[model samples]
Target: MRDVLVIGGGIIGLLTARELRLSGAEVTLIEMGQTGRESSWAGGGIISPLYPWRAPEPITALSRWSQTVYPALTTQLLDETGIDPEFTINGMLVLDDEDLDQALDWGARHGQPIEILQEPAPHAIEPELGPRPARALLLPGIAQLRPPRLSKAVRRALEKRIDLREREEVCELLVADGRVCGVRTPKGQVEAKRVVICAGAWTAKLLEQLGTPPDIQPVRGQMLLFHAKPGQINHITLHAGRYAIPRRDGRVLFGSTLEHAGFVKRTTAEDKEALYNDAIELFPVLRRTPIEDHWSGLRPGSPSGIPYIGAYPGIEGLYFNAGHFRNGLVMGPASARLMVDLMLDREPILNPAPYALNASR
Candidate 1:
């Protein structure tokens, strides 16, 4: 029997397993498919929320804590696994001004640096921007990483430390005497003293036996990638609800569309066209560049966009570290740490009340 069993092989599960092993617990991670091939691999990997100032207080807390630790975590992973996650502080530029006041107020309250630019100022920051909007908001502290690289790095780090089970689907939770003792896999039953559901979009389905699971559902998001010059686009650019991310290797990722399609991971031509047009509008140079790839991933959506990171009210040995909606990458590390802290009854990094299983419900 393992000390802990983590369901899901995305970033959240991978990190949680790592944390548990570090705390001297025997951990086993099971994924329905290959690890890191889900939303963790499909995300753009912006280390901060899309608009940091606009996120709720709980999200803001998790994101801020994660940002502080990402540099060190990525460094350690690179040193141990020799796989660089390419953590970079490229900053971000927001072109919309509808929430300027709210953004400014939030930034001031959080002590986040925000610069309000006008006309030529915006163009000076990003030369590729076709024409400067009337005004722009520059958040110089934002950072980003290559999602695929980060996922690979984390998985590599966890391989030798834990019983990492890939392509093994956890079909059901084994609850005996009102306590989750282990999980039922296709092969057989695996026993563990404790279990955590980091199943992302499939979290709710896995917990269906327990009536009224956390209000989590799958929200589909599509993205388009373009091969451009390394320096073609300097910083992450956002306009309306879409944004363009420039990777270190000159690959620009433009996305995405939030749709309510159930378990359908297929990309649509309509979304591809819309993303391409939006990318061009954001950076005119993309007009000449051809799209290299197009894909979609299902994000675990919650009512408050806050993930649950504690034990179920009446269920023993069962915990959740899922339902992060769109900010999974930004909040993964902190969420994983918080989940482990709560499970072990240790001092938590942040207040656990906001992320309790019953908080959102």
Candidate 2:
């Protein structure tokens, strides 16, 4: 029997296979489509877990821990596979004073070098933003990664021996004699000793087949990207209104409207216009840039805005690591680590209390 069967090809599933394989376990990863094309690939790729006022503690902790591993991790992947995740620190800026205060407090408490700047700091693409006001908090270490690149590298690294089964859609968790023994897929039955469901927005649907979907639904997000003035905005600047995330390359990812509509992955004209209007306001020079593309992804959102990790209460050997919402790209590595540690050996880096599947109970 394979030591582990990861039933999704997103960041968490790929990372879990990596972690478990590091522990010398035979792992196989299954994906219904090309790897990392889901919400994991569709995110803005923000690295900082620090929200302005409120953020979940367990998830935030995991993000911080993952940030430490990213440097060595991405570099090693690049060296081995010649695929750069494009990990770069572009700094995150806060515009609102109220939000900035919350950021300062939390950052100081957590050893984050969130700087409070009085004067406008030197930034790339200053002309596009068109004379923004001063008062900004700069998180020097916060950054971004190319999600598609990381996903490709991880797939390449794991596909050799991890039994990567793409285009294999998992239909149900096969429970026999009160234990998760395998999974039912469209192609055939995958027999395994254990199963890990990492099915992002589709997690609830899969779990419902097992009779325990944990109140997770699709929170649709609309995003727009532009090949704007090269180096117009270098830092990740955020306000209560919108966010502008600039990559090491010339592209600027402006985005993401949080809507509670269920399972709608289609883009809308209004959301597109809204993003552009907000982007130009943040940096006015964007008026000249062509709208490169627009897209949407359905993030798995829970009521409390937290992901459920660890084992399912009723099913033995059944595990869930879904419902990450917006933090998937930022915080998936550490969460996957915690999951592997807990499920493989029943020991985790931090107390897994808050993120327990039954935490609300």
Candidate 3:
């Protein structure tokens, strides 16, 4: 029997397989589609949450830990695989006044350098912004990475070390007598001592067959890409609730809309027009730019806005590291470390109690 079977092929599953293999566990990762092409590849690559001060402590902790280690990890990956994920610290600009005082207090308590700006200062930083948002917060510690490149790097890094089974959808868990022994795919059965569901948006559906359904649902987010000059936008800009992320290759990513659209990954013209309008409103220079591409992905959303990252309650040998929602890219690396620590019975790098399976429920 295999030592472990990872059920998803997004960033979480790919990294989990790497960690387990490094720990000397025979690992096999199964994916329904192409590896790393799910929500992991479709995100805007913001390493920090939008107004992170409003997030829960567990979410904040995971994101902060990821920020601490991502630079070194990306550097190592680039050295090894010749693929630069472009992890950059261009910072984030939040142009909203709601909960301004609370966010300031949270930043102070957490020791994150934050500058609260009144009227004209917001316009001075990004002179192209609309006149709606009169206030802003500049968070210099925020960072971003090109998600597609990071995904490619991880897949390349695990090329020889992991048995990557793409185009294989896990239909059910082979659980019996208080423990899960394997998984059932369309082709055949995969036997393993441990099983991890890192399937992103499809996780809750997979677990439902085993009678312990997690409160995870699919949230579809649509994004638009626009080609622009190199110096079109200086920083990752956020106003109201949408954002525009400029890439090093002069591609500005205007994102995203959260909809409960049940595993549907279709990009609509309505959302595209809405995003374009918002993006143009955020930066007037974008009015002349043409949209190059548009796409959508389903993020795994949980009721508590946190992932279930522990042994499934009462299900031996069955674990979960899914339901990270939109923060999967930021949280995946550290979460993989934590999950491997738990699976191998080692001391966790961070407190794992807050993200335990039952904790969220």
Candidates' C-alpha lDDT: 0.91, 0.80, 0.88
Which 10-residue span in candidate 1 carries the lowest summed lDDT? 352-361
Error of 2 at 219 (Å): 1.1
Q: Which model is ahead, 1 or 2, in terms of TM-score?
A: 1
RMSD to the true structure for each prediction, in A, is: 1.0, 1.9, 1.3
TM-score of 3: 0.97
Residue-wise C-alpha lDDT for candidate 1, range 101-149, written one tens digit per residue: 9999998988788999998888887888976568999999999998888
lDDT by residue for model 2 over 26-134, one digit each (tens)? Answer: 8878889878998888888888653634777766787778888888889989998999999998888777667666777888888888777765453432434455556
Highest-scoring model, lDDT: 1
Q: Model 3 off-target regions past 4 Å?
A: none
Expressed as tens digits, the lDDT of each residue in 1-361 for candidate 3 is 9999999999999988888988999899999999999999999999987779878888888888888999999999999899999998888998877888888898888888988878888777777677766678899888899998999999999888878899988877898998999988899999999999999889989988867777789999999999987777878988778998988887899999999989779999899999999998888899999889999999999865788888998889999999899899888888999999999999998999988766744
Ranking by lDDT: 1, 3, 2
Per-model clash counts, in order, read 0, 7, 0
